[model samples]
Target: MNSLYHGSELCEVDADGNVAVPAFLEDAFAPETSPEIVVAKHQADDCLIGYGRAHLSTLAERAERRRVAEEERGEEARSHYRRMRGTFGLSERIKRDGRGLRIPPAMRHLGRIDDLALFVGAGDSFEIWNPQLALESDDEHFRALAEFRLRMRGTKTAGVH
Candidate 1:
């Protein structure tokens, strides 16, 4: 079976730009191989999506099927190239070290991430969001979750005991 990701965790990002992969999501990584994750921009949102290295093959296969279908319809190659560029060209594969994955600068900019990253799992993949920005998300579920996280973070930071 494929690695499935679910649940959410808020992780800290260091000054050097490393965000620890939430322990809950560890199952996404293969035990035998070095930990590697692919980070890409969410197609319809201002957030980043992450998945195990193995998922890349799934993406390629899907893209190939789309290409063939488009070709059968006599569609121009532009559509395929556009899809490839968006899905492959803009993505980056980063390896996790002892501390965590060093988020690439380009991805950070694309994701608008800073000191805190909210990781929300979405079955096949997970999303990394800048909590503050996520509060304005068009997705009601995401917006509500982000608000709850921010409130929880505030409570913890200001806890008396």
Candidate 2:
């Protein structure tokens, strides 16, 4: 069975932008093959999404199928190109270093992450959020979780004096 990621962990992002993958999520990664995870900006959210390499394979397969289908229609595949760019093009395959997985500068800017990242599992994938931005999320669960965790960490959310 494929790995199912569920649970949340708060991690510190060091100066080099490395954030340790939570221990609970370690089993989901196939370290023997490659110690990498794909991090991408969530299309509709102000956060980053993460998944194992296997999920990247699945995405490639789906993209290929879409490409083939577009060819069969005897029409330009602009949609396919757009989708690919939005998905694969914007993603970064980051390897795990000694400290942890390094969040590339571009992705770091895209996700607005700094100092602290709150990892929340979303079944097949997980989310990387800047705890401060998470506090503004419309999703009550995420907002509350971020709030609770920040308090536990003795960190105060901005404008929350």
lDDT of each: 0.82, 0.84
Best model per TM-score? 1
Q: In lDDT terms, which candidate is top?
A: 2
**Residues 1-161, model 2: lDDT tens digits:** 34778888889998778888787677666556467788999877899988877788787788999899889988688988887887888899998775378999999999999999999888888889999999998989878889988989899777655
Candidate 2 residue runs with Cα over 4 Å from true position: 30-33, 63-79, 159-161
Tell me the TM-score of model 2: 0.83
Flag regions of model 1 displaced more than 4 Å.
155-161
lDDT of 1 by residue, 71-143 (tens): 9999999989987887888789999886478889999989989899999888988889988877777888877
* lDDT value, residue 92 of candidate 2: 94
Instruction: Spell out the clash pairs found in candidate 2.
Output: none
Residue 112's lDDT within candidate 1 is 89
